[model samples]
Target: MIEVNFDGIVGPTHNYAGLSIGNRASFANAGAVSSPRLAALQGVGKMRRMLAMGLGQGVFLPHVRPNTDWLRTLGFNGSDTETLASAWMSDRALVANAMSASAMWTANAATVSPAPDTRDGLCHLSVANLSTMPHRASEAGQTERQLRLAFPDPRFFRIHAPLPAAFGDEGAANFMRIAPRSGGPAVEMFVYGEGQSGGFPSRQHRTASEAVARRHGLSPARSLVVRQSDAAIAAGAFHNDVVAVANGHVLFAHEAAFADPAALYAALAALVPDVVTIEVPADRVSLDTAIRTYLFNSQLVTMPDGGMTLVLPGEAQENAAVWAWLNELIAQGGPIDRLEVVDVRESMRNGGGPACLRLRVQVDADALAAIDPRFLLNETVCARLEQVITQEWPESIAPEELGDPRLWDRCARARSALTEALGFGTDEL
Candidate 1:
């Protein structure tokens, strides 16, 4: 079996409009000019870094943005140009929702269960019905179509439609799995948030978590549902990935991440053997600092060696407390032995870190070989993608420019060129 990290390519329309309610970074950087070219290349560069580290790396192409279909659904009528102008004049918020580029953060793409963990012994994936945020809710249908296109063999992989909007499933960002090894006996952890009266929004509802687990056919004995702290949510941890991350047997989380930390850890210990729980104390790294630096949002990946490595965003290094905690964790390492930091400031400012960019999909060797080869990234593929991004992607994008007719043309050109280069047919995108 092999674990492949599928990283989403940042879209050409990426901008900050203060869209996400509970994301502090998005709010802080609202109305700032964004570099679409830099964002896409930076994400691809991270993919290349993962490949260089001898890890399996795959790429998910960005969906068509400035989605005219969405605008039409919002009751805007006329030619694409007229519709955009009318929508801009009528409701800028609706225009913003239609033009969202949040699909780059594929951590919320879907909830995937490996073949070994599923009831039918076939890998299962449920596209996230991101109903909490209007911008993100539009991604569900396109994401599901893309997943099915990528893995066409239904016998090996099963793709489930998004749950009803009432469930509000946010996908893999709130879900984690710990296996004894790569192949079997995978214990799944589903983390949810209580959407109560609070300063911040709780995106992951408890009922949504339960619905996803049942839809995915996860084993009850090996599955657990834990609650995210109300304090953490109010502190701007919109999703659980902001405060907790797990890989294999290691779980790196903040002290205030969960409502019942002791019970969760004890249950994990009971489910999986030799589970390593690395909890960063609030004193060592305050919740405010953790949310700010995205220290715990780092991806804890099991390296080629038996040990693990932490893939962190550059912001973590800039913060003194988070940086010190990193050093301490490395010094006292058992599972995690190395730290690798990458610059993703473009995505970081929009509240996405290294872990937020990728989805962890485990597939057996044969199933892995069956995957679409065009999506796999190596040195040559990475270079070609970078060249395309540099030439085709716009250097910068402003919020007001989203209504420009030229923007759609340029985005279409870039997306078309990318899909053609990737050998993906029309249905694939």
Candidate 2:
């Protein structure tokens, strides 16, 4: 099966409101001016890079911003503009949550099981509830709608709704799979965090991960659930992806990534006999330095030429320690042969890196065809997206400008234009 990376386009209302409590960069850059146009362009640029490498690339449209419907549920009433104004006056934080573009981090969009690993031999995807944070909790409905539209063929795909809020699910960010190749039986690892006092909250619950594995029909023998290291969480590695990522048989991670690394490794080795474990010890790279540079958040993807490549953020290159380790890794002639760095500084300021920007779906030829063609990317699609972003997206957004009626109108128009350019009807998106 081939792997397709579906990236969420940065929204017209993309800003730094520091909504994610556990994300260190978000808090550090809170209230900073955001350039929506630049953010969208940078996202499209990443897509272009993927396309150039002969990888399958797709786009997830931005969700409608200034979610007036949500505001109405909070007791605000009137036209969309009027409701936004009233809500802003009463509770600015509430309005900020409504306008969030967190959906751009599509890695949190869902937990997916490819056909090769499922009981019925059909791809299964469970949308994440994201119930931990208030701003993110409101994303489930829209996420489901988009998934349903993109994967309409029930014969080849089954898209399940988000789990109940009681079990907090954060999707693929906390999930990993190890296999000899994409089109084969694999070991699915679900990493969760136990709640603790006096630190950032643990978003993914053990019960939630178990439910997803059960719903996906994954075999008990091949499904492994483990706890994320409390130290990693306290160190600002909010998601497991922030500390570890797996592609095919390679598991690249920090030594302190899991609560019990030795046991987890033994279990994984039993499941995949030829599994390659590339561990970066704390002495070589501290967790603090890793999180600061987002070294582990790099996308570990298999290239069309059958070689593995790490798509890292530019910040990784700027750090001396991180860069030294990466260079040494390549020189040692390991499974990871090369590194390709891309600039996503706009998204990086809010703590999302290469791996955070996209969701990886493994599909065979027939299954790939079942997906909506409009969602897939090509040279023409990229060009059209770039044009829409350049002409419609706002150049800059100050924190205080979020409540302005004019800003709301621009965001709405930008999304509408993007949908039209992508051949999607306004009502469909």
Q: Which structure among the candidates has the greatest TM-score?
A: 2
In candidate 2, the residue pairs with backbone N, CA or C atoms under 3 Å apart (3 or more residues apart, or in different chains) clash, namely none
TM-score (all chains, Cα) for each model: 0.97, 0.99
**lDDT (0 to 1) per candidate:** 0.88, 0.94
lDDT of 2 at 158: 97
- Residue-level lDDT tens digits of model 1 in 1-429: 689999999988888888998899999999999998999999999998999899999988888877878889989899877888899999888888887889999999999899888788888888999999999999998898788877778778988898889878899999999887534497898998876526776777788788777877888898899999998998888889999999998888999999999999999888886788889999999999999989877888878886799999999999988999889878975788999999999999999999899988999998898787887888998988898889999999898887788987898788888888778787567
Residue 356 in model 1: lDDT: 91
Alpha-carbon RMSD, each predicted model:
1.3, 1.0
- What's model 1's lDDT at 367? 88
Deviation from native of the Cα of residue 140 in model 2, angstroms:
0.9
By summed lDDT, which 10 consecutive residues of candidate 2 come out lowest? 179-188
Local lDDT at 36 for model 1: 88
